[model samples]
Target: MSRFIPLSVPNLKGKELEYVTKVVETEWVSTGGGYINEFEKNIAGYLKIEKGVACQSGTAGLHLALKLSGVKYGDEVIVPTLTFIAAVNPVRYLGAEPVFMDCDDTLNMDLDKLEEFCRKECTLTNDGLINNKTGKAIRTLVIVHIFGNMANMERLIDIAEEYKLKVVEDSTEALGTYSTEGRYKGKFAGTIGDFGVYSFNGNKIITTGGGGMLVAKDKNLIDKAKYLSTQAKDDELYYIHDEVGFNYRMTNLQAALGVAQLEQLEGFIKIKMENYNLYKEEIDKIEGISILDFNKNTRANHWFYSLLIDEEKYGLSRDELLNKLNENKIQTRPIWGLIHEQKPYRNNQAHKIEKANYYIDRILNIPCSTSLAKEEAKYVCDILRELER
Candidate 1:
């Protein structure tokens, strides 16, 4: 009970050490190596996508995806305010602005509000969807699959096609998630969009220490992204650079870790699902707090479990509960603050940000790591129950 239980952490009990040791033994420690290629292929094959481009981090992958989507200066991209700020920062990196959208009960972008914003707040032009307020072209939609829950892609894709918007799926937290029904049946969260991005951060569902992968429906786009990620080398022999590029390529060490981690992804997801169900069963019986459920039509990775606390019913505010848990050595965390309210994005457009604000204050992420023991989960629940008035 004295040990600090973390909210989320990497599970590396696979071939990570063996693969990375091979990389080190071969002296292929930098970006150029077999590990990177294998990691890319493994991720692409896992998601059943055409191709993937490995990059330094999820932020880098997002930047590359936005650039490949033809998002330009003076353009606008739709994003969710309920997600990590990294998802929204890429829009600005491309010299475009982000139009923050609200979240639904599932904490994904509100499809209804997105449709409403596109229909009532913008005008369809020969070029594309144009914002009436700023007269800027609304070029792309960045959809973050928050906490591995698949967004309503079936409806979102319809909205994108009707409005001529390129869709970028931020599948950073949804590597193992897939749709089990509808037109995109069996499609992974990242594959159905114009571009899909995944993260391998230290605390993600998988870890490469730090890296990311960019995938797209078009193989040519993947090729271009790989080119850009490695400094746009038109001719590597001459070190010729025809276009501006970035040093976003992932290291051989990271890719080695990623390749091994990806091999155990299905198993890790199994553990995550089991732990999530265990928490749900126990927390459901506790008044004023319950575990949020993923979409029924999809097999989610169950990356992170959200604990919804009703202040009045729970007898404590989210922060109060968070503090008590931390004091008891349980590492619980509140959801990210609404991005629209952040200082840097304060002036950006946020349409009907109602539900996001409501959830932001009530939702706390509890310990759900793949390494979390069953007794540890029970201990967390017992602490919550004890703290409940």
Candidate 2:
């Protein structure tokens, strides 16, 4: 059997080893070192954001964003249910609840339903913020940029502003993606909203082994996130503590790898886009499968290539196709199961999940690793062709 094509994986060819080796040689491996500082600067410089906070994981970044958004114990946060639960779980971490919204064709937050849900399920207070029917202030909106394709940021931001809500961008899947046309022109995914979070997990466009970055337009917010991530320590040298804080700092070793990975991110993104194009070209001809597309106005990172299976036309269920691919060692998988349906969040608020269901049932993620060579792409395509037959 051929080597199994993975859905996503890290590609570290440049200075990953050299930087990690330097960290080891220098013995600053635990945390807080030159590499962490350099990695933060590199991220801020790359995205041109006001500031960035390096954290231990993307979920940690989200937790900080939620806290910065003023999400308290009794608050409600509007979140898309179609995304990875990590995007919504942070709400729970803050003792807040998530009011789940549906996704549009872009597999992003459905703007129309988002508006309607806010309108129907909420009432505007004198401050112009939407309050849930139960009167929990809908204080923030968490928008996940699923698969490196953006949510309707223009409309979502407008909604957020009108409702006096904070916007937390879960750009964990959208590191290098941006809007080509908008009020936030040329702004990167995580930078457009009130707060943005990114992941550098093993499967992301770039990997820091285990790291993520948080960005914001406000310096105070960035500082606060950094403070919160560092376990809210009052004094560093004296070990004085005024408030609770977490050890969510990304280590120097991770940051060293991040610095190298950031340098190669654009090139990695190119490979993702190219592989997506080839997948479209190869799979569009197969019956019962439709290539997923991004919104025309935006330039996506093309991080994940999705094929929506039309069971009616293709004459096979999505799981059946998934099983077939797995049996053939192609390593394809489904889009995330809706967050609302997850075991932990099964009882959360959900509004108009029709389109999200439509998407989740049919989408298949092909091998989208940057390191996946052209021959691998051909092999996966051939297996897909065989599956269609």
Candidate 3:
């Protein structure tokens, strides 16, 4: 109880050091090395996907995905206002606009709203789905599997097909999440869409310090992504460039960490699932706070846990509880401010954001780190229980 319980932290007890030491000894610490290729292949194999391209970060992967999806200047991309800003910023990176959609109870894009927006507010043309208001093509749909919970992809995919929108699954927070039934049964979060991206940030279920992976249904596109990531070398020996490229390749050092971290990914997910159940069982019994649940049809990675608080019942506002938790040395954070309301995005179109607004004010993220001890979780619950009185 004396030590601060972080909201999320990397579980590096695996062979991270040994693998990184090997990379250091080999002197191939930059982008080109065996670790990079091994990490990409391992991730693609884990997801049961055809190929994966390693890159610098999830944001970079998204930018590349959008570019590969044919998003261009003056185009628009459908996105979720309830997700982290990284998911939306990539659209702007391509000089495209974003149409922010609301979130369902799962804190994922509301497929109902997305379908309605496409059917009622846009027109499908030979070019693609065109926004009635802007008259620009809606080229892509970026779906973020928020907090490792799979969005209703079965329904979303149909909507995209009908509207002619290319789908990009922003699976940054859902590395191991997958559907257990229906069409996408056994398909991992990042594998079901036209393109999918994974992050290896310090706080994710697995960590490569700072790196990401991109997967696509088409093998050729995967090859293109790799070329674009590594400076678009037309002829590597001559450094001939046929087009614009980015210095976004993942370093061998990071990939070494990723290879080791991935080996323990399933184990990390197991611990996360168990801890989530423990938190839910105890927290649900409290007067005004309860743990958020993932979709029933998917096996989520349980990356982060959400605590919904009712101010009238809990006798404290969400901010009040956040401050109290900080005072008690129990680290907690509020859900992200709706992206639509942020200063830079205030003018962007956000459709029917009722539930997202409601959830934003009530949701708090508590300590759910993979390294978190059971006793530490118990201590957190005890504090919340005591606060109820």
Candidate 4:
């Protein structure tokens, strides 16, 4: 393995150059361009949503969604501790706090504990669901589909409705995931919630250099999110501003790349799924480690493949294997540290985060780029087997 296998990287072997060239030729490379609108439409159409609004990044889209979800100052949002911090930071951006929730076997928000928290720890009032611990309104829940795997949306949504909590689906890692057997069958990850957001970062399933899209069940919310992303211009002709807004508009260049990337998205997903299955087969031959599968009820995009390592059985610790693989020119990364354990969020309320802590130290993300070659994957597995020996 002379070449280093990257954990993840964008696959841009399509009309990306052509589309970006068109944007440059038409001099529409800024925020305004035909490609931006088309990209939004293509994304919305793919997800079977009414509309999609492009923003500078997923974090910005989440911030706008949190604002629209009516998470006012002092409001509380139930978030997952096992996910990237971006999923919970938007709550702070809106002057609200986040009550961190634990992860289940799927590495998603534990719906059982979530229900328990609502039933035993909180009370529903006229204002909203009030958290008895903080005496603040529980206004929303941010559900992140970890590693392109769809969470148990069927149960999560029921709990949300029963508790009157607005749902925001952080589908940043799950753009192509959709339910197959449920009431929301055929509903995409982002479309099932009140608001869903997708990331087009360089390392995501797709890339637009760096950008995101926001979709919602209601047209007005999507429209307003679009407006707020572009500085909330009430009257464009006179440049009149109506409210505090963010300059979070995605560039025409990025959207140009996005449209081209979206065209190849399904094909990319196919390759990713195939590679994931291949890895699963090879890794299963080894002892003390296993590749975790996605929820069988949904079709996942397979953005990342997580390896569960049992140190005693594997003969090597997770950190030891990580270092060995990287030294052998294979890139691997540990799962994110629990959000509640981070310094900035340590003092925030965290509810029974047991499984998250357990998996955080054992889960390792191996190379899973859409463009990863079969030989490279085999090379990666060969190294793992060597470590086991």
Considering summed lDDT, which 10 consecutive residues are worst modelled in model 1? Answer: 42-51
Model 1: per-residue lDDT, tens digit, 61-86?
99999999999998999999999999
Off by over 4 Å in 3: none
Q: In model 4, what are the clashing residue pairs, if there are any?
A: none
lDDT of 4 by residue, 1-389 (tens): 79989999889899999999999999988999899999999998898777899999999989998899889998899999999989989899888999999999999889999999999999998877999988999989999999999999889989999999999999999999999997988989989889999999999999999999998888998888988998889999999997988999999999999999999999999999999999999999999999999999999999999999999999988899999998999989999988999998989999988999899989999999988999999999898888895
- Of 1 and 2, the candidate ranking higher by lDDT: 1
Q: Give the lDDT of residue 264 in candidate 4.
A: 93
Stretches of candidate 4 exceeding 4 Å from the true structure: none
| Model 2 lDDT tens row, 28-132 | 998778999999998999898656899999999999889987888978888888888789888888899888998888888889988887777788887555555
Provide TM-scores for the models: 0.99, 0.97, 0.99, 0.99
Candidate number of the best lDDT: 1
lDDT for 276 (candidate 4): 98
| Candidate 1 whole-model C-alpha lDDT, 0 to 1 | 0.94
Model 2 earns a TM-score of 0.97
Error of 3 at 173 (Å): 0.2
